[model samples]
Target: MSENNKIAKELVEAVGGKENIASVAHCATRLRIMVVDKDKIDQPKVESVDKVKGAFYNSGQYQVIFGTGTVNRIYEEVTKLGLESSTKDELKKEAGKSGNWFQRAIRTFGDVFVPIIPALVATGLFMGVRGLVMQEQILGLFGLSPADISDNFLLFTEILTDTAFIFLPALVAWSTFRVFGGNPIIGLVLGLMLVSPALPNAWAVAGGDVTPIMFMGFIPVVGYQGSVLPAFIAGIVGAKLEKWIRKRVPEALDLILTPFLTLLIMSTLALFVIGPIFHSLEEVILNVTVSVLSWPLGLSGLLIGALNQVIVVTGVHHVFNLLEIQLLERFGNNPYNAIITCSVAAQGGAALAVGLKTKSKKLKALALPSSFSAFLGITEPAIFGVNLRYMKPFIMGLIGGGAGGFLASIFGLKASGMAITVIPGTLLFLNGQILLYILVNLVAIAVAFVLTWMFGYSDKQLEQTNEA
Candidate 1:
């Protein structure tokens, strides 16, 4: 048998065969298996499977790590074992049932925001480049004055930096629709309509550059340019409404009427009702978050940094995308990303320490790549596969992250983008503060490494004991 098939067979047996698996799915790096009987799992055996870095049960799924490309192969192999397989969405639905109300809500928030991150990340990198080129020192290197730079080139940069936020509502709505089992295209259309050119631009209205047209005499209605909550809430309402409409409409007419009524109804509700109310709520939320983030002595920074990994483990870290967006919209830049980058670096540092300290060949192989992955701002491999497995390393990482975050806040480190961190995140600070960004990351890595080496991990003594 092939290596994939070999491992797949072992994994299935370790999880109590195909009968115990209610549903199986893979996400990025882990095979998320929902099992009928948790006790039936042979956890150690699962961990020992070839190419399997680690295994854990979280929320409601038995997650087996196979790292990036390997997980997909193992997933395909597992499906061939006559077990029921599920899409990411279907797995999310099943897993959602196991968590408490708060946990479920956080997961839902992650579901909505995670899909929109790539757009934000791309925009952020463009913003970083834009910031760099606009710098006097950077322009001096090219012997070009700010006025000497072509207006057309500057205009293109503006488009790159501005387009994502300008159409953020549509992105949010589309993802929300997918999460809620609605027609994504229809959801996208409704979202686009919420920010139609016919309405006053939201940013212009906010800046008092354009007056919002009065609706029903008193309600000031404008396009939801950078608004998130309204589009997300509208998506849920539109999706549920569309699903309800789909059931009642005749099949022949369903194709035509369902989309029409759904769009028409959702557009009306979003603009006349949901948009105005949620915009106000968004403002309030932004204010609260800003207040907390601005807390004295870097209190908020330390708290968020220390617990960020824990949040990521629960799969709700994507909500930070919303917070980052809000911060950038209100303050023209986000310091939170700077803080988050430090936390991310600490995980890599801790994993590196563990990798160097471990005596087991399997553990060393797993730790090295996972650490590198963490440094590149995808920390799952390090977190689930290594650090979290050794509880002390995780805590040491948090302590290091908190210290780094506090320093970042103290120095007022900020970024031009929401996504991308650690190594790639250097671009966001390249305009003038790259050194500070580098320093914070170095501090995080150093602290986590030293602390983890001291107290976070051991050199296979426990493994030898278990074997004996």
Candidate 2:
């Protein structure tokens, strides 16, 4: 009977009901989907639904965007129909349990860290281009080796990059408020108040050292600046609060009253509790990760190595990203870089191994190019076409990745930046026998190829490789 529940049902129906969908998952701005058949999907119907903006297909899934929490509702609706919300490719996973440790880890990493990627990529490319462009631009006005060019560039880069996080409270408010069904502006306003640098640096305040909040608390809407969790929480809370206020206020002036009360209550709650709690949670996650990685480098490396292959197969490799990224943010560097570097190298090796082992000219060709891609930091081809479809190569890849990851971890090597691909990915770590790490990865590939060559091959591949 509630407006929210009614809207949720209507939204689900708009997406073509239970029969039309095969599975679903969600990311920051999109709902990754699988339909019984793509043609059966009623794209027009779904798009027509309120709050539904657009939909598209990518990487073999039909994705719908209804903001943030929208995915949860649709997911709930799909489960009500008893159909799972996962891809056939991800069929190895169970339904609700898809929220397992791996899934949670991956989702957290992919969601939190992905937002920074576009800006970081832009900044890196900017720095790269500036090196080439600075002198040219400087020639227009001043002289060579212009004053503060590099310094200003670095400062600009830091400001732009840090701004994304520094103003994160408002940013989070905007996204999350939209998700939770509140007027997004309210959350944004709340975020601005909290993150505005003018506030007396409230977040760092200690128990006895200073007051929780200074003059800002005296205002009607308390600021939450730089805080993400509370703004995120407020969006949901504000939406709910707005809904309740809606019923009590006369319809004649409902809109104004709803937002006013909603923003006031949500911001108040956010300042007092939500922000601090989430910040603490982030700390806890950070501490746990550091402790585990530091406990025994060798074992951690071994675990990443052995499991990384399986995680990749399940598209669960993202599961480890949170540990990696969060630690980098909190502690300034991560030990997992070595393992990841080796894993990538192992990908190239696996593809090469599969190519060498296969007799099917088609598979060999696929494997060869895929190996090149993996070496360059792409792994889908090897994963789907060679390793997964053919079991032996996949197993060999696991053995290789596990061994390489373990070795790399023990080496205590680290990477300063995120490696997007394999080519330069090879450049990720240069400390501590980096060459030896390279050798280890190549050796894994060779062993995989030799093992698969000796024991496994389809007759087609056997004839093809033999004839070649």
Candidate 3:
């Protein structure tokens, strides 16, 4: 079995076994389960698992946090163990997530990228503002060159981003244990121990050097500072271990003894095994990014442009921010982000078209504002309220976006700086003919507007909606 599969099986048993669960599903960073008996669900028992975030019984759902990359693995493991079944009730829960394949695809993509967005955005704006400051010499930003100011900031930003990911296991443990419906305070304590520097340095052990914290080595001291994999794995281990430790210890001394042993064992496993394996996977992903973008620019841009629009809508769009700003800062002109510019045009055009076709004073008011908002790059209001609700407008917008992004890629278009207007979208496109690129963007939007009007304006639905 895959290691994740083994961990899931153990977790399933720990949480009062598989039969106790009614249903389960996962989104980006959490494993959501519905159990038949809440009483059988032991909060402290679940928190004991090193890989879990604490559990919570909110909205009648048991939510478990497993950090970023680990959720999928857990989902795969959960399915293999038969916790999630194909049934109507389950499908209904998914309805709110997304319905059509296109929408679901968008949601799935967003699920992967959303949680990391704040970190990504903070890092990008940090670099951008840092760049502007040095160029203007406002703060007299010190660096080897004007560009160096931004580069230096990114170097520091990387530390923050990398650190969060590095001890990802700890994050998962902390979150899972808290959400597990236990004493959340204890779960948070478990999380802290996984990330604490007091743990033995696993890196030293891997490198064949004796750990300075020799006592911790024999005992499994996990160091999760800015780490991802170890803490997560440890959490899974910790969860099961929690159950075993609970029955033996009396209620009076349970708090101190439970966490102390849980950390001692789980952290060791994290340092020696979980952290190392996940760290390797991260290296592989970085290498792939380097290899993929190294190919011809035109093809790269087109692919990125197409995928970018498809993924951005689901809110996972934040993941691409790294590909655009961070990748370009280092590798130059990240073509992957080029596709998003076309998406903005497509949605804005569709919204405008929807507005023009509607005569209902109320609908017209909604659609017109939606169009303007879409133009400003907030397309969800337009997508969910205006386009996807009807059907044709959404398809038309996607087609328009695809075509526009494809063309932008072919022309070697590049975006230079972040700007608000549609005209400036082309500024990033290095197409020697900047004005031509802007015109093309306008045309793409117009086409979307026309297509949406042709397909989406149904007399019956409009009349019905108007009546209501």
TM-score of each: 0.93, 0.61, 0.52
Evaluation by lDDT, superior candidate among 1 and 3: 1
The predicted structure with the larger lDDT, 1 or 2, is: 1
Question: lDDT by residue for model 3 over 136-182, one digit each (tens)?
Answer: 34444553455445666767755643544444344456644443323
Q: Give the lowest summed-lDDT range of ten residues in model 1.
A: 459-468
With a 3 Å backbone cut-off (N, CA, C), the pairs that clash in candidate 1 are none
lDDT of 2: 0.58
Better of 2 and 3 by TM-score: 2
Write down the lDDT of every candidate, Cα atoms only: 0.88, 0.58, 0.57
Residue 187 error, candidate 2, Å: 4.1
C-alpha lDDT of residue 322 in model 3: 33
Give the per-residue Cα lDDT of candidate 3 at 460: 64
Model 1 residue runs over 4 Å out of place are 464-468
Worst 10 residues of 2 by lDDT: 88-97
Top candidate, metric lDDT: 1
Q: Count the backbone clashes (under 3 Å) in each candidate.
A: 0, 13, 49
lDDT computed for candidate 3: 0.57
What is the C-alpha lDDT profile of model 1 across 358-458, one tens digit per residue? 87778889889889998999887788778887778989999989988988988888898878899999988877889999998999999999999998889
